[model samples]
Target: MKQKAWAIHFIYAGIFLLLAGGQMYAVESFQLTPSATKFLAHNVGPGPDTPRGALNHLMVNSGADVRETIRPPGWIAWAALSAGAVMAAHGGLLIARKK
Candidate 1:
């Protein structure tokens, strides 16, 4: 009886994790739009002014490219999602056995 209960809980948690993990991965890509101008300015560095100039310099002129800052990476989210799926499977088996 207890194991069956656990299995149901695992399935629920797994579904939640899958949704949350996908959202997290998506948000990272969205950041580029909001930060575009600022990214160019900083990346181009001190010297020639203006956002347009900076953009042209960064993309068109392209003398020295700047490296983007790194994030903690999405592997953790992937891991969470994978674990959740396993838990759900195990839980499902338990639930099935109860019948």
Candidate 2:
């Protein structure tokens, strides 16, 4: 029973890792700038679409203003990669341990 639950951890880790990996690959392979991130954050609204005139919201709190000349923050990719690694390691430990 517990082992089965541990297997589910692999699925969760794989999902997150795949998502972040895909994003990083897209950004690197396509040379995407911060503008793309801004567009997704503002229009696509990964968090929320409607603000309802609120001063502070998920979209508002997402990212810093991206200048046209500068590329997007590198930390975004690193953070995503780090998170995926941590999740993968956690899932791996859960699956490999006998106890």
Candidate 3:
């Protein structure tokens, strides 16, 4: 009974990690709309050449529909996917061994 519980826990953890990795992998690029830009500027505070200033500058100079493109690095997604796969496989092996 204790071993089964442990296996179940591992499986659940693996599933969560896998889902997170998949979501991370799916987003190659995204755009932040004008409103989102403004929100960020407000929260990020002001500076001459910082992110907040950049966002503010965009809001002031660009059209209302203009947006900022954000691209996260590829390695982060790959790392998550690799880690999640390893976790999930380890969990599956734990479950199988119990049975």
Candidate 4:
């Protein structure tokens, strides 16, 4: 029973570490600048300008602004990754202990 618990612990720890690593890497690689929107039209397409088109553009731009504002600091990512590593190590220790 103890061995089985330890094995499970190690498995969970490994998964956590993998997730943390990926998240940290993604944040590190992310750009702070907002990218150009390929889907949004600068002006009303072919037809006359309508309130709907203006509203759509406004919504898209606002969403982009929110995303840009909400990015986590690099240090935060490092801290999260560190926590994940610690959890993984603790789980490994559990696995190594005999019943």
Model 4 TM-score, 2 decimals: 0.44
Shift in Å, residue 23, candidate 4: 2.0
Per-residue accuracy of model 1 over 1-99 as CA lDDT, tens digit each = 777777888899988887767776665643343255345555655544777565555653464434344354678678867877787788788788889
Query: Please, what is the whole-model Cα lDDT of each candidate in the order they appear?
Result: 0.65, 0.60, 0.72, 0.59
TM-score of 2: 0.42
| Alpha-carbon deviation at 68 in model 2, angstroms | 13
Cα-based TM-score, every candidate: 0.50, 0.42, 0.53, 0.44
Residues 1-99, candidate 3, lDDT per residue (tens digit)?
787777677777777777876776898787887778666655654863888587676664565665657787878777777777777777778878877
lDDT of 2 at 77: 70
| Backbone clash count for every predicted candidate, in the order shown | 1, 0, 0, 0
Mark the regions of model 1 whose C-alpha exceeds 4 Å error after superposition: 29-72
Top model by lDDT, which number? 3
Q: Which window of 10 residues has the lowest lDDT sum in candidate 3?
A: 39-48
lDDT-based ranking: 3, 1, 2, 4
lDDT of 4 by residue, 33-83 (tens): 434331433442322267866655665567555222345567766676677
**Of models 2 and 3, which has the larger TM-score?**
3
